[model samples]
Target: MGMNAASVLNHIINGEPTTPCSSKGATSSQAKALTTTIINHLRLGRLGKAVSVLFSAPVPFPFALYVHLFRICASKKAIVEVRKVESHLVSFAPTPPVFLLNRAIEAYGKCGCLVDARELFDEMPQRDGGSWNAMVTAYSQNGYAGKALGVFSDMHKSGIFAAEVTFASVLASCASILALWLSRQVHALVFKYGFGGNVILGSSLVDVYGKCRRMGDARRMFDEIERPNAVTWNVIIRRYLEMGNGKESVFLFFKMISLNVRPLTFTVSNALVACSSFRGFREVIQIHGLIIKISYEEDEVVSCSLIDVYAKCGDLVCARTIFDLLSPKNLIHWTSMVSGYTLSGKTRLARELFDRMPERSIVSWNAMLAGYAHSSQWDEAMELIILICNDMRNTDRVTVSLILNVSAGLSDLELGKQVHGYMYRHGFYSDLSVANALLDMYGKCGNLRKARAWFYEMRHFRDMVSWNALLSSYARHRMSEEALVIFWEMQQEATPSKFTFATLLAVCANIFAREQGKQIHGFLIRNGYDLDIVIRGALVDMYSKCRCLDYALNVFIGTSVKDVVLWNSLMLGCYYNKQSEAILKLFELMKEDGVKPDSTTFQAVLLACISQGCVKLGGQYFNSLSQDYFIIPQVEHYESMIKLYGLHGFFDELEDFVEKMPFQPTAPMLARVFDSSKEYNNTRLGKWAVRHLSFLKD
Candidate 1:
């Protein structure tokens, strides 16, 4: 068996030649014996020796032998062996068959060597449907959807008609690039080829529509599959899960069960993930119970999803119970448990558990690091980041993205630049999410130059998030001209989301651009983005800050449901416009609407009280701050009361209020009081303020 094949494996490792690839004058029976020996070695998992024996053999292998080796290597994804076998067949095997060339193409594709696969396909003097399908599958499997479609086009023009497998492979390519238009074209071809009744082909059509997010078309095709098997059921179920319709996905899962289709490991895991997506605690429990009854809980993937769902639903006790029960734990189990604790905000326990793990992946590290970010423990996060940067074996795009976000949260621009350097070094800069995170970090840290550079670099592949990220950067720094210009450019390519309008509204408010704000408002109505509360509130805020209190009030009145933030915005608008009476009236209307007032709501109310010199009314509201509303008075609340008292010359109330403050008066409070006393020619209160100020300075 050449058990010591690893010893001579240096023949391939160091680019040395093996024995002759041919044994001249060898009999067919002898060749068959050698082929059986090599296959026996391959079946025993002695791939090194099998390859060693393959290239070392005296006899050239049969075409069938080459097929076997290539098939096995394709399954094992042994690229080195694949190249070795490919070279041998091309050099020694005179007049290789197209089917063998097709096998070689399939092998290279499975090895993620699409370049070699395509090159081999191109060199084939003749091809059948298999050759073109193999090339299309090679490209599609390796994430080259455009290339796959290109080969399919050539296949069509070459007069080699598409088989059912060709359409299935082409649909997969369509799904990958989300090419809905091309997918529709392919769907017409599927029927033109008269494979419409094929269940698996129909499922592939469903996949193309599903991934394109045209779920209505997906469902239409899905229902056309009259006798849907497990694969078909899984396709629809998984697509719904991907689309984040957890309830629908779970319903399909139950429907599959009712139809007596026993879900496999993949089906159970997908169903569990669906349950977790919407935090369906009751569904999760039912699924968990079902899995336990079927002994499917013992499956590692199902167990991992169970832990994740339970942790996400805030049942850490149940999650830990599952985690502790697993035997011979692997990295997935450990990472899942750590992520559970992190998601639950128990970073300390997460860290302790993480330290105890025998091995760690970038995912576990990311989960722990994200906990620090969530808790705002930037210092601890930076220290963990140092450890991560040192041990970067598993560092991926996720790692780069997480570290960039942490740097942003810390507001450490230097650290962010270092991470940017690391990303460039590690080839993560091209990852869209990582690049967007880098852009966001630079923007948040007030480094416009770096953000703009990344924005330009990302333009070709940029999505809505990338455009919004750059827009947010401009808005944050009040680069009004740049924001407006970039938004106009964004509209030509990416559509603005609700949050995009929110950020734009902030830009409008910051620059007091009333006309621009009006346009955005009209755009919202025209585009049907007016329903979002946050966007509507942004519209109110934009008009309010532009001194158009009337427009702000109209938006506030038009919104069917008003949150406290919206009420505060309108009230603050009145206060800014010197319509102090209107602010008080809005507060009463807010109460009548039964919207609970938060701290900011009262701040606006108190500012209005100060404006009108409503001494008695202000006093009653100030008392009601804690008595009736139970809103604990903050320092700003106390300062507002002092200003109200001192402004109207209520000296007794002012003195008593200052004395009754629970904490020492802030400097602003004292400064305002002393200034008011001086203006009113009150020597006693002025003297009292000066004494307190001196003592506070001491």
Candidate 2:
């Protein structure tokens, strides 16, 4: 095909003027053929020959010649050849026109050769905002936010009136930089320039606020707009999901749908995330159905999001089904499914799928490690950490955090120390997240001394997790005073979270610190954190343990909502106060309210029975434990049984049961029953107690 076309071109070029027999018509035909050949060469990117043919041929070249060459250089990012074509244009019989300069600017911009593009824009004696917009766009595309802003400023200073494209480019810069203040300034300029209502500008404003974590502002802008495009809806909805307002995000989706705004692939993906965050299977299915209805169900982004949504919401089977159907699975799709299994505590299945993956990313490894850590499978988590440590490609702060978390659950002080050494050797000890995890691990593993050392060593700026870890450590070690001190420090320096109040409440419960507990309660109510269940439960348990039963009761009754654990706290408080009637009433109330009693409830009830010598009720409840509640009697139940039996003069039965029991009685149980023989004999209860105590003591 090439040879035929080239021969036709040669014949036309050589025969054009020599024949002279009405050769004007022949020459026209030859010129047309030569131009066709040159176009084909340029299209094929045979640049040398195309340039030669253009320069050597008698046929005149069109503007298409330079434009084609510019495209090839831009696509290949061949800056040298692009400049060559420009220089050749200058030597042309007439200089290339303004239209040609624009093509060159676009090419340079696309190729990230902004310096050259800027030079060209400056060299132009006559300029327009379009030319300046091109330069600003080049800077924005290349991640040069500062340069983009500077160019935008110059464009304004030169009195080049801003156009929609100009504002759009500047907004891109602000969004990249997360410069909300600058973005607002740009919005004002857009309004000043009569481009405020532009769909493109409105979308950029929504995006800017979302990036700045100002979702409310973004929503306000979205609502203020009379009409919003799909991009506007997508940006706001995505922000809602990121902010953990999944319900609001879904509401926005419904609103968008009501307006008949069609969703794109991005919209479907975001809606799927909202579904996952809410963990509403029905809503997820609804979104999935909508995706299918919109014909984006099979799209790569949408399908990946579907797998993620289902996996996050614990629909692993559906996630796996979707994974099997995707023809070409990427890393993200595989990672999502693996993360789902890991998070759901199905580590074995997650590991199986992880190994089956054709390839893995660092995120996949992190997911597997985190799964093991979360499920308390410490050995496996540590093994993966060792593997990651040995492998040069996989080591990172996230991996270290996973391993540290596992160590925290195991409370293996020795292994935690080893991880600290490894972190130091790798120069990762200074990484705040890694350091925080290490501090948390040491705290959880009961090495509060070492945890405190690491805490003080951390850079002065502390995050919530840092403070929470330290406070939790002190609480676990019964150092309530120190924990309270740190908590107040946290409140003074930073905003306290539910974890902060919860940890402090735990300390108060441990030491029965009533004054401190009330202070935290006041803080909770003042901060509007009283309704947070974790914090509320902590306060209830603290007040109960501190012997402030009246206050505890008020808080407990005031809250209309209560879970099983909350009821358990109240019942335990009654047991501690020796208020047997209150314990029974609370248990009946719990049952009436449909809150199932747990092991703690059984413990509290048994203690109440032992306190009052309610043998008939104790035996009945003990039998109910095994038959109705399916609770195999633990050591505490046996201790309570022995006490009840000893109190009721069932000496032989207690003695025989103690002899055949699976474990030894605790020190307190022995002291309470056997060491009281003097008082027992004085009270005429000697014979019964001696019979049970003789065999166990011997």
Candidate 3:
């Protein structure tokens, strides 16, 4: 053979050899040749043959051979070969060198055998900085941040001067735990060691500060960087966006662009998120143009952000166009499209897309369930909830919250109780949103006692929504005194939202409590809530119902933006106040304001005509309901029509209207006809009304 041990080791280290193998069962010379062959095999990446040749060797190999094998095994993270080499090293000598021990420690740590690594580290008689660094890096890499920090402290106390790598690893551990003070101490050490100018170190510092919500400090550190890379800018922008300063983030993005810095996919994604915050349609479009300019339109994350922003802006057409054009629709993109459709009130399209999805995530299912709940499709929502509970192994809190909302909408107390039980069994009863939804469900279903019990039981979990839910329950039931008491209690516990005030005003309106309503109005004016459209509508209705037409008119005229609902509210108030002429005049003014009349508007105007006994005017408005505004008459509209005919003693017309009514004549309709007959002393009409009433009861 041409190879000696030195040359063979050199060849193994170089991953190549010049010699061929000899036969097995050989002399010492032949064993040497075979050992060269095994090294050569190992060098060629044939691990199995090398191990086989090593085990089948006639005698134990030289110490150099085992050392080289150990080095190779450690590098490859071959734990079995490492252990085998360790066994050979142990039998060959009483003690292994520090270098071999360090390699073994590192190999074990890299292979996630931390216990073995720690054992070897502790068994060593002496160690170097490399030993400590490997352990620290291992602990940090494996999510033991606090342990890594403790090890670093021990290394410092052991008189090992920390290197740049050591400081870097420690800084990473500190950042992971959000140890702001410790990170600051590390920063001081970095400058003391003159590594403060290092770009990687600076980036880590910025990240730590950003995560700790010290944006000002993060910005200052970022400015100190000589040439911040794309990642640096991305970090600062993301930090700003996370801190809810979208405008600042967008401005910084433009500044980065002005400096000719290339934007990455994350940069564009973050910028799109910033655009979504302000609903700046112009900025969103401009950023989209930039995305197209940079050829990131095809990127999945960027595309998803664009879809999300468009959906939030209520531009479902654009959102759908983007979604349709995506080639390979991922789960996230599919979920976004479903959510967009649901938000736009296109439940049918959402359901179709949901059914067609190749795979469904919990989020996708939750989106569809929430859509049904929001649209008041309680049956469909309940069906999907049952399917999810049975088919899916786990469900999140959002799913439970949505189902609870459906139960509330349907006022199905039994179903709500069942869901409550399911939540208790599934460990979701502690979720505040679920609790609030349960309270709302019970309240809406007329179980205020249960609602009150649940509310009081939520000692710490009660948030603003919980208080408002209970308050709205009282308001809805016209428990005026109880609502006022809850209102005051809520004011002491949590700040009342506009919704709370709106509910309270509704309670006042129902009970015709003028003093309480005026006090609330005063509070509204003092608190600058007088201009909220909901509060304004509630006030107009309350005052008009209280027979204070002048006060209601002032509030109505003071309203700058009079939607059809507000006009209808005022007109209805006038009807209730017996100002029938004012109702017609308000209708003319509404037409002048170009506010399209809804069914409520038509109902209010028709009610006014009935109050004044103006049959012709009421009939004209009823005709216009379909002809002028194209609003199909609802049940309320038909009821008003019957009342108009009955009040005017149009017995022939009233009977004809009853026969031609689109729906079966309800009890109120028969009562109206009967009362009209008694007023006019018409016994025949009364008998006809009596027959219809009897038929309806049967």
Candidate 4:
């Protein structure tokens, strides 16, 4: 038909026929012809002309035409046209058929007009399985998972048999809310209805079970499917990856290949991720070869996974090569490479790439920020925060969490407070991670009061990290009683982690509470936590500080895996117990056991030497700090050296050492020298020490 004929047909379809002939007794042929013409117009993107035709149709238009019109409107989310269609349907036929009314409901729901959709659903004179399913699917798809489940319950109570689509929708709703109990109930219904072994339904069940962290059930569902598709295998493999069983995921992928189920982009992407978890170059190279064999190496997602795996496996050269070879590097490719560089501790390279990014996303910005935070480059992290704020880039929980860690590391309470204010203003304070990070930041910055306030303010939102953060702060600052009280409170509220015990043990060591330390140690042994390295280290330190040298020795000897830190802890304990000779013996034994001495090791040995008045041994260990062990001398190390020299009355050596020290002398170091000089009755050196000490204090 021509444009004129099309316009007249639209007028007639909309129920505003311009001619009596158009309104009178339209034949089936004429109705079909008009429907085809209107559909053709709709297909050509002439939505306005198509709607005009529908609205201008004769009264009581074909039910099929209304259905088609609703479908088109729903796809386009043309709420206005949908409303017009509904009004026309109502006015022309006061009571439409159930199918027609269901179509209207579906249109409204699809357009996000749930209120109107629900109203129409309630106003329906009669309901069927399709009508109920429409409402359920609508609520589920729009994030009203709870309401979807409620409607499904209502549908069940009303005695309507749900179809396969209905079951899929319900399973999806269960998955959305992570309602494991509800999903199990649905699984029972699916089997009862003989939809068991239905591959599609089985896959949906596998997905929900996987999401609920019930991997055993997900595996059971997968095995029951006689001929599972690639999608089903993908879900199970991805599930294994999620559960951190990457080896199993890779095995499954190989099994799928043996079955000749061709892998898709997601399948390859997930397998590469599984390989990445192994952190072995051999595994990543094998997966990279497979990507090449399958010709998915160029696929953006698969390539990004390769880059990440290579970087994680400590092969940055390969990762960069893959990134450079990408045909048209999108934001994801750029961000992945930046993250790879950051992960490998190449922050300068990461920043160069970040600056070269033509289009930066929040993810890219976060990658750079996280790199700086991970490397403890606090100043650079703050500078990035300023750039982000100036550029008005959106910040998410990861960004805020990274910044809070930076603030904590730098002990910048002022900067932390400003970030907290930003969080409060931007509605990010309610997020659990951000809230926990704030608590940690305040605690690390020495604001225990503010940390406690934030903790109590979290109320029911508190997680294990929240409790541990506050408790660790108390332990770190040596508030023994407060730390114990908080530990008891935490025990009452939540189960403690090994870190909790370690912190509590530190508190005991600080206060020299041997009895309390024994109690905590007993609890550790009783709870089967004695083997943990951190708890073991803490136990050694605590017993040594509390003067229970026998207990500390037993614990240290009992540890199967003795790293340098553990040896240092035990040596420090001996020093505290005045067993200077034993410190020297343990140091020799530690070296014999192949546990190389660290900075703490040297510090402990030097203290032991000072205690025993072994001047030559002290000087030998102090000089060997950098030469033998390659351990740089920190301020504390230098202080120990000064104490060693001054205690022995080696006035000339002590003076030369003070003058040639790497760093400028602090007040504490000069005060120690002054005290030592006075004790030895060296008036000239003592006077010089006093002058330097005065200058430092000023």
TM per model?
Answer: 0.79, 0.81, 0.72, 0.85
- Considering lDDT, where higher is better, how would the candidates rank from best to worst? 4, 1, 3, 2
Tens digit per residue, CA lDDT, model 1, 1-698 = 36554333322233212222444445444555666667668658898778777676645566656776788799999999998888878776667778889999999999999889978887888889999999999988888889999999988988899999888889998898889999999899889989989998999988889988989999999999888889888989989998889889999998998898878878888988888788888888888888988898778888998899899899999999999999978899999999999988999989999999998878888889988888888889989988997986668787788888888888999989998888888788888899899999999999999898888988788899998998999998889879999999999998899988899999999999999999988898898765568987888888989999889888888999899989888888888778888988999999999998988888898899899888898888888889988989988889899999999999999999999989988778889999999999999999989888999899
Candidate 4 stretches greater than 4 Å from native: 1-37, 60-64, 89-103, 122-128, 157-159, 275-278, 525-531, 588-597, 608-630, 639-698
| Cα error of candidate 1 at position 552, Å | 2.0
Report clashes for each candidate as comma-separated counts: 1, 0, 0, 12
Cα shift from native, residue 172, model 1 (Å): 2.1
lDDT (10s digit) by residue, model 4, range 424-518:
99999999999999999999999999999999999788988899999988877777799999988888789888888888888998999999999
Candidate structures ordered by TM-score, highest first: 4, 2, 1, 3
In terms of lDDT, model 4 sits at 0.87
Span of 10 residues, lowest total lDDT, candidate 4: 14-23
User: Where does candidate 3 stray beyond 4 Å?
Assistant: 1-228, 236-261, 273-298, 314-318, 487-495, 512-597, 612-630, 648-661, 677-691
Q: Note the Cα lDDT for every prediction shown.
A: 0.86, 0.78, 0.83, 0.87
Q: lDDT per residue, candidate 2, 338-377, as tens digits? A: 9888878999999998889887778888989888888888
Q: Per-residue lDDT tens digits of candidate 3, residues 1-698?
A: 33565575764444322222223435446556667788778757876677667766545455556656766666677877766666655554456667667667767766677787788788878888888987887787777899889998899888887777878788889878899999888889789879878888888788889888999899999999998888889989999999999999999998998898999899988998898898878888888888889888889999999998898788888888988998888999999899888877788999999989999999999999988988888888888888888878988888888887888888889989998998889998899988998889999999999999999989677999999899888878878789899988888789778888888888888888999999988887788764688888888988989889899999989989988878988998988877888988989999999888899998888888888898888988998988987888898988898899888888888887788877888888888889999999989988988998999888
| Every candidate's CA RMSD | 6.6, 6.4, 7.1, 5.0
Query: Which residue pairs does candidate 2 place in steric collision?
Result: none
* Backbone clash tally (model 3): 0
